[model samples]
Target: MGILSRILNRRADPPRQTRMLEGASGKRWPSTPAFGATGSEVLAGAAQVRGRARHLRFNDPTAANAAEILRTALVGYGATLTSGAEETDSAFADWAAAVHLGELEGEIIDSLATDGEALIILRTDDRGALRLQHVPAEQLDESYTVELGGGRYIAAGIEYDADDQPIAYHFRPARPTDQYQTFRAPIRVVAADVLHLFRRQGAGQTRGLSWFAPVILPLNELSQLQDALQVTAKIQAMMCGFLIDQNGGATSPLGDGESPLDVSLEPGTMRVLPSGWDVRFTTPQQMAQSVELVAVSLRQIAAGLQMPEFLLSGDMRGVNYSSARTALIQFRR
Candidate 1:
């Protein structure tokens, strides 16, 4: 049986009768100790009164002698000479009990506030010393994050493809709106700083993309810059998909193409693609201009990626590409 069940059974049973010594010659038994008295107090009291006389007869000429005899009789009847000592011991026990009760009540109050349950157990150490121990509640779910950094290139986002391979993307240019005018420049590597930011957003599940229109630069200017720099650069720009993964990692570099989404060549003006579609812009350029273009291209590229209808209609901070696309499509329809 479980411990609680056994305890309940014991409490349900009737109290057992205790045997007491009885005889005409025996001294009167003292009243039983109060409820909740410690075992120490009960034992001490019994020892103190084991052999003491209550009164002495003085009329007898041999009263002193008789008193001594009565004392002996009291001893035979279970009286002792340590009544004062027993009283002091019982008072000490009472004080200890009061302190213990207060501590127990305080623990109960604390547990209630925290939705916790306490388990009390008795333990014995190697030295045979007995102690009472309290165990606290445990949490079933816990989470944490880790950050990793490398050089001046801060990781803008890390994405897992359909196959679950991690693709890390870095941006030299900062901010989503930076792509407005200069869409054809190669991003500056010197300006890039890599940082790994992690978080526990929710359960292990991929979230839907939030779309935004990215401005794409023209290809003519991009080719000329690539020729001048004598670098093999493929300038491409498109809306990209992004989301916070279950592990709180930011996912990006979305869309199909040779170049990462939201990047450009030095000379071409960036172009904005159709909403709710993922696109790619590839370019190779020397200098910090390419990095700057990458930062500014996110707006148009993200707008081109497909996303859930609810998210597109939801009240978000940036403009909703889905709504804009729907309006344009309605006019065409």
Candidate 2:
């Protein structure tokens, strides 16, 4: 009896120890723990940063340009829905058309490009017409949760079953853009009534990362450099030259060869130097290498977004027909 009990206890032993990550608060935990209600083990403090990136994609010029290019390229041609003899009539197509006004696919694709997901609410308005509203992912209450019969859950505004199927989505009762009437509870909608579209990268992945997430930092740096170059050029253009009396000569206002002596560097104004002073005009060096450097960064961004360089930069200087066709073919595929 003692030997049999020892064998049973040994069989019930837990698994061996594994590597762990130390949090900023000095708490050590496993990198991949068992699934919990919130599942914070995998995506600890990621949503806020992703939300900021979505905002930047709208305000940042480079991100906006890339997103726009993607939207136009991916959904420009539009798609056709075919029905067979056994299928129903054109009512479905007509209803979709009425809902989207000929830009259904484009809108959905735009949402994916910007937010990495799209929420579509299907309903009928007062006029009995099918109204399809595209809701921003930010509107979903990621922190909201409720206890029900099945088990405790981490709502994150979306409920999924064991098989990773979406069961329901909880939306904030108030519109994000609305400024008034702040008191409202969350509204839950079944999965059948709404379409939540996203590209899942893994078996248990739930949240979506913005398409611009990877290249955001690089794009912002590039934009800042370009802006600095423009500002430098503008300042150089606004001022012609400086009158300097390097030899400790007369410190009075100087005149140019043709114009009167002046101290200001305003537009259309030329300065003349004293006899002992010299007028030194800055020779602006051509940023011949900047074009190449900017192109390289853009290429990286394009690669990250799975976009072609020519499409984002609109540069065809060195692109021949063969190369352009090949690139387009690959991008299309």
Candidate 3:
């Protein structure tokens, strides 16, 4: 058959059913922001996120407690390396004691949660026994990379083989703000000598982002709300004063007067105002529902933290035993 004749004889395919939003528009999805980020791409913000996370860890009690909670829940008192071979048992004990395994594990977990990754350099003692040196995550900048030609490549400070496996890591000098360090080349360490710990969020992702990424905004909101409420309470408390005119000659402070009379409210002491003088306080009532709102907000943060709300909040008023058990079971898993 000729080409034109064959084309005219082509079969007509039936249309398939499709499903989509019935009436989607900007009004329906007001802000549809999206990020097409790979694992390596996400590390671009890891440094900032890690800095904020660390700041919160130090200055904010809630954040500090959350890190502790995660450490406790995951590592607890840590594990013992006991296989029970005569010499092996003794060697394991010495190594564990030398490294302070329990404390080291907890620190590593905290680093993973706050810094998004734990950079531990493996070293050997004089006897060739293993040793570990924990380095700051900030020492490794994601911008560090080298194209090694062919399929092998160094990306985001990590060197990968042609098979796409990490072969080594390149770490910048300790002091990032130093001009000399900034200009210096990063130190390259083989993957075998370095232990990189992180919880990968996506497949083929080269690096991990802070676990707090999901909850940072919510946490900041909660912190700011609490601060606002605290300031309001303080203002109300400090302004709560009684006006007095012992001689009743000070006149009404609202009208033409020398100055507003200040009266102190002392404990276990009382002072009666003179006649024709009245005390009025500038007390402003705060929102009664603020407590409930905070509780609800904390629950939202708790969801992001992957823990039971009661555990995060220490509020067991509405938490039942069965519910607590279920939540803990899920968290433990």
Candidate 4:
């Protein structure tokens, strides 16, 4: 092309615009991740995360109470039938009572909070009266995904059609850990026959992650720290420490000039060490007196779960009524 023609083409071209996010540039670029994980990776890792959360729920008071607090706030005392359909209401109440619906609701809430998901298997009695069963959400195997051609597929144990809406669920009748039942094939149930409860956070996400995911690591670390402190407290209480002999004694002062002594002391026991020897009790510091660090971890957990630190830790040291009220009002909203 002629120089004049090229100049005209260059003038017609759009201006160059280079865009780079601050977090994704220069020294930060390599560390700043562009996650390509599947949308349901949360579901994929649910079982292990659920197991840890359940352990905390059963054994850790803070974790257990977190779920309890949520359950109380969300489904306090269950629902009441006050619609004023006297005859119909009474019958509905009776049916609800027969199925223990009130308690069932609370349990379901607990499941969702603690397990990140819940399932209510709808059933009927011999006479065809409706009943409800609350089972572990893990009953639905998230690993059981399959393609069935024509846009019909099972993703995260849920069956979806061309439009990607759930029409059924596949689950194990027995716990996945049950060795005897491990060989049993998954049982498919229509979506209408089950109530799948979960806190959906992302679009096209087929499974729910346990609410504990954000705080699980911190809680576990805190638990370990507290445990270490407890053990340290026990050793500190009894003066259980190692003996350090500065004079390089052949044997422990408490032992004949043979192997080092294995001494056990009780309360109020008076003992003397060799003139050149001293006791260097193996008593470790109580978690470096990390009371504040522990409090900080609890706060992290509370923040992750969106609960008041006072509520989660039961520490009212700095909580005044006004502060608590302000926090709770925001929470209740």
Query: All candidates' lDDT scores?
Result: 0.33, 0.71, 0.80, 0.82
lDDT of model number 3? 0.80
Judge candidate 4 against the unseen true structure and give its global Cα lDDT, from 0 to 1. Answer: 0.82
- lDDT (10s digit) by residue, model 3, range 1-333: 999998998879867766476445345565775566666457667778888888888887778888888888889777766686778888777778888988998999999888888999999989888888888786765887778989999878889999999999888766535555445578989999999888877777877788888888888888999999999888887876666666757545443443446445678866555466777777565456887889888889888988888878888886789988988887866
Best by TM-score: 3
Clashes of each: 63, 5, 0, 4
Score every model by TM-score: 0.14, 0.73, 0.79, 0.77
lDDT of 2 by residue, 1-333 (tens): 699887877856678865454442233445645544334522443465566566767777777778778777777766546667434436766666666645877878777876777888888898887787888776677667555546535457787665556788888776557977464677888889898887665555566656776787888788887888889889988777777777786656643353445455657865455567777887777655776788899899889899888888888888897988898888877
lDDT of 4 by residue, 1-333 (tens): 999988877866679875567665667578666655546577667788989999999998788889888888788778778888898889888998888888989989988988888998898989999888887887787779899999999988899999988899998778545766454588999999988888877776677778999999998898998897778677677767777768675344665654455477778988877688777766455457577788899899999999998988988986798989898888766
Q: Which pairs clash in the backbone of model 3? A: none
Which candidate comes out best when scored by lDDT?
4
- True-structure RMSD for candidate 4: 6.0
List candidate 1 stretches off by more than 4 Å.
1-101, 125-130, 139-333
